[model samples]
Target: MTVLTGEMLIGFSAVRGQAGEQRAFDPATNAEIPAPVFGLGDEAEVERAATLATKAFDAYRTLPLARRAAFLEAIASKLLEIGDALIARAHEETGLPRARLQGELGRTVGQLRLFANEVREGHFLRATIDSALPERTPLPRADLRLMKLPLGPVAVFGASNFPLAFSVAGGDTASALAAGAPVIVKAHGAHLGTSELAGRAIQLAAQETGMPDGTFSLLFGAGRKIGEALVAHPAIKAVGFTGSRQGGLALVRVANARPEPIPVYAEMSSINPVFMLPDALRNRAEAIGRDFADSLTLGAGQFCTNPGLVLAIDGPELQRFLIAASLALVAKQPQTMLTQGIHAAWQDGTRALDALEGVQKIAQGEPVKAQCNAAQAALYVTDAKRFLADGALQDEVFGPASVLVRAKDFSELLEIAERFEGQLTATLQLDSADHDDARALLTVLERKAGRILVNGFPTGVEVSHAMVHGGPFPSTSNAMYTSVGSTAIDRFLRPVCYQDLPDALQHDALKRGNPLALWRRVDGVPLQA
Candidate 1:
């Protein structure tokens, strides 16, 4: 990967706005990577982008769905074409393996294709037209049509853990572009180089497809001030974010505190718990323990859906299996986390876990050093009764840490599942012989998470059309929308109701010509009315 020079980083105005200057640094070597950082947008630039988006939305929103879909497909092709180089830069910066970067690149392209397909189909418009009744005994029904319209400008905050899939060219930006909403992305400082590379690719695609020049913007910086200024700016109509609960909540407060609070879809982290039944514990106790340890430490436990908590029915069999499984996790070489802030946060999480009363440490990891990487590992076991009584125990630790809860009986196991906050996914370890009891527990977990698995881990999120990513609050601010599948575009749109208007005045979507031919419900029949 070529190192970006200070001169190359000089500010350039792509949209009508003026982006501010911010310095760039290399996270891997902790040295200055470039000078005169030109991409980082300030409050003034944000205002200018919003103005241009509002001006452009008048024409962009009326474009046929097929045309919009074609633009998205072009972006997808560009992403696939440059997949290898992007993955290499990602590995150089984050210290991740080639396979992981390749997988994430696939997911990013898959999301773009999924959104394009969704736009082409046009069901997301959710058009509903109520036929008019000119004459009735007492009342007359008026024609009313409803279809989703793009919010003017959206502010997207990138995540550190997923630089490619959640950064400049990630799901949020792709979905918003497909929805006809112009986007301004706040890039994470941890992966600025990766963001710049992908950002250039997107610009090339936009130019090739004849998209509006100011439609997409990428900004990078180290402090919270830039983000706060962007969110609080009046031009920003909506916000999309993925990070810690505290960071998400702070953005939420900013949006809500505004004159006109916009919707903030913040996917905060969670302790996606896996419940292991006693019967399964008796049968594959050793196997389950090993799998749990592997899943807990996968990617150094940087995933938001990492299984940080484990709930199992208490018994001698369960205890014996967990002890053997945890001890088997030999102290491996420490790996670099996403950023220094993440590393510090991991230590804070470990401190919180250690401070919990009655928590027994089954294992401990070596401390990370100044120059070399370090892996701090530990296993804390506690009683289910204590877990339920202390609400503080449910907080996510954000690393390769696991808390095993020993429930006294089957009833206590069910109670623990019910008490869990919203999560991305929940896993169940069950024995085939105990199908009846497992079903009971599975049913309880279904309501608590977006995806429920049987005898599997929740760490690997498949980027498929059938995937439902967002869950209840704390997991995500919106449960009805997902951030990983074709459905993610819905978050960038808002429903617009149309009343009495001639064909000339009506939007193309509602015009008699039915130019887009999108599916619509007219007089209780599914048709393009």
Candidate 2:
């Protein structure tokens, strides 16, 4: 077992925090794991981290793209070097299966490499140039150049659900660093041990790559004081977060209240509704039910894209689907959740639904004895009208549970779709015959979700250029930005246009010789040199 010092990393130094001692818990055993005591960071430490990050941003952002890319690759390599020990600590802290944590670790490193490739490609800079048109008929146009630049130091809030993939050196940190911004992470309390290990890997990578000293830092906080202080600090320019709606909104409020408000790209909440078209539901109701059950129970319904709401028209086919789904759910055994607080919250959400009028508890999975927190799978049924009337039905339960809504007709289904708040994804299970209805529903769904799936579930999100892991307000703070894929780097970047500047003062990307051999828009036309 690797011993942890639990000190906060600020620049190249590890300082003992003043917020007091905290420990990681084994959710599977419901016991405090015998681990090193972690120091909770306070306001003063946040100031130190913020100031260092701000100072480092200048030189770090000006480094060649290749060097920046190399830094990211080095971080990925270091993470892999700490492989087994990191995975074990993550498993103990999150109560996630070893296989699952292993897979997440792969994703975490894979994304870092992906970002490196994206940086070297150079297109992300969006360089453009329009030469002066002094010979034009009436007036002359001055030479103009444009490109995106980093948004200074960024603050990333770690997520509890994905200890490895969304914590310390996760997507936010990778993307921000790739965009040439310094990063200050507020580590999630649930996995401080895991976070400390990853932070050390990043520190080693920074040192090995000869990057700026304050390029990265990790802070611990048992409560919101540290996070609040970091976000409100003047040195911090932007924020990236993934958590519950309440937490995201709170950060948004803090950012908005800052002396110079900054953008907060938060992946907050989503029920991720799945719509079953009549033709498909009628043709393979049983199969769809079984598959849906599997997705709902996978990871104990901890995924942000979990199918928490299911929609279908009322009929015999719908009845068959519900019956099959209930049967599949009942056979599943209760599984451990991430924490005791999460399990207790899940129970409260389920109990609230069970007590609501016109909502029927279709079935619940078999109970299992566990040393710690566990959640039993559950399925509920309710009419579309009743569901639309009661706003609580649409709220996410954050566990292995889902609500199936039966609409009277296709029109009612459309109305139900319109009632949905913003979502990360809205899936459609359709066949050839359901094309027209699918088209109609799609028109409405386009405004309600970031990603629309055809004949598939949303649990598995592909990390690629085409993926959109963000949505309108409530789902995320900014729908225009994503927290996944190559484009995620855009969140930490801003465009700057230079007008009539001398060649000597211009950036190399916009220089006369086209030194970087980048793709740019020249004189209102596309140019690749």
Candidate 3:
């Protein structure tokens, strides 16, 4: 067994933090994992990590694209090599099922390989050549060529829920590294052992692939002070964060307050809403209701894209749907949440919902006997008038809890959709008969959410090129980029236009022979050269 020594991976060195110590706690047993006590870093460690990343920036970004892609693939291979030990550690730490951790490990490595392929393709560079027009009738134009460049060192904050897929070697780390930015990850407090293992995998890959020292570093820290210090550091040109709205906003504020403000791609709070059109409700209410219940409780509804709100017309069909949904929810067995803090937050949120005047509890899952951080699924119902009136009703409960809204008619449904602040995903269940109504709601939903779906739930986010796992405002800091796809690389890249440079002086992408072989837009026309 490879023993874990709770320490920070600062470049090529593993150094213990001096500020404090933390141990991973098993939410299922309500006990701490005793062997490895992680030492937490403070502002001093932050400075050292950031400085090393700065030292490594230029060499890392200018490496050959093939080597970069190979480096990513090496990391993926190393993770798969870690195998069962990784899954066991994650399961023990998170209280999630062993099967789920196994699946997430696959996802984490899959992301690395995907970004690896992305690097090989070189399309993300967006190389363009607007040739000089020396013989133009009017004024002659200057020779201009453009391609994207890395934004220097980045700070990634590991998330609590998807420890593998959104943590140390997760999408944020993978995408930023793919874009040639040195990454410094602040390991999430809940899963310190898990972070250490994955960070070691990355460190090994970097060294074996001959990547520059400080290309990656993982830190263990407590509270916002250390995290804020990373965001506020001068060397960190950008940040990628996944957490609560308050936490994300805090980093955003720090980044903004910096002398040279940088972009913070933060995936925050979202109560992904689902809509059931009248015809669909009339036809398959029971089926839709059952599936909704399953999605609501999947992974204890810890997914950021979990369907937290449902909308439908208030009629006999809707009532039928509610009955089916309530019965399905009531039959579900309670499951353990990610942490004690999350379990407590869920309790507080559900209790607060219970106190609301117009909202009514429709159903509760089978009670947990003595399981430590277990959460019983909850379902609530309220009218559209109440849902729209009380902004408190829209707050995300962050667990296996959902609110169903009864809209009087199509107009009221549209009103509720328009009222949504922002969402990661919005879904619609409809038949051909409801096409017109669905069309009317489409325009509003497009503006309100990043991804839209038909006749399906939003719990499973696809990690593909075209898929979008982001949204406006509270859902994500920037509505322009995605957090879980090929386009995610764009968040860490900035376009640079070189003008009137000699062919020998130009980078490979902008050279006259097109050495990189990237698809180039020449004089506004795209060509494969």
Please tell me which model should have the higher TM-score, number 1 or number 3: 3
lDDT of 3 by residue, 8-84 (tens): 99999999999998889999899999968899999999999999999999999999999999999999998898878
Residue-wise C-alpha lDDT for candidate 1, range 1-529, written one tens digit per residue: 3334211111224432134455554445655545435455566655665676666666666667777787777777877777777787778667677898998888888777888898888888887777678796598877787888888788898888898888788889888988898777887877766777777667667677666656777766557877988899888889999998999999999999999999998899788888887788898888888887777778878898888888887778887777766665555445667666777888887888788897877775545566323346667899988899988789888878888888888898888888889888888888777788788877887788888888888888777778877888889987788888777888888888877766688766666667768778877888853
- Candidate 2 is scored at a TM of 0.98
> Candidate 2 lDDT, tens digit per residue, 1-529?
3358989899999988876888889899888977688888899898889888988999999999999999999999998998899999999988888999989989999989999998988889999898999898788888989999998999999999998888898999999999999999999988989999999999989999999999999999888988999999999999999999999999999999988999999998899999999999989999999999999998999999999999999899988998889899999988889988888999999999999999998888987675468899999999998998999988999989999998999999999989899999999999889999999999999999999998778887777888899998889989998899999999999999999999999998899888888888888898888
- Model 2: per-residue Cα lDDT at residue 221: 87
What order do candidates take by lDDT, descending? 3, 2, 1
TM-scores, all candidates, are 0.91, 0.98, 0.99
What lDDT score belongs to each candidate, Candidate 1 first? Answer: 0.77, 0.91, 0.93
Looking at model 3, residue 498 earns an lDDT score of: 92
Supply every candidate's count of residue pairs whose N, Cα or C atoms clash at under 3 angstroms. Answer: 3, 0, 0
Best by lDDT: 3
**Which window of ten consecutive residues has the lowest lDDT sum in model 1?**
3-12
Score candidate 1 by TM-score against the native: 0.91
* lDDT of prediction 1: 0.77
* Rank order (by TM-score, best first): 3, 2, 1
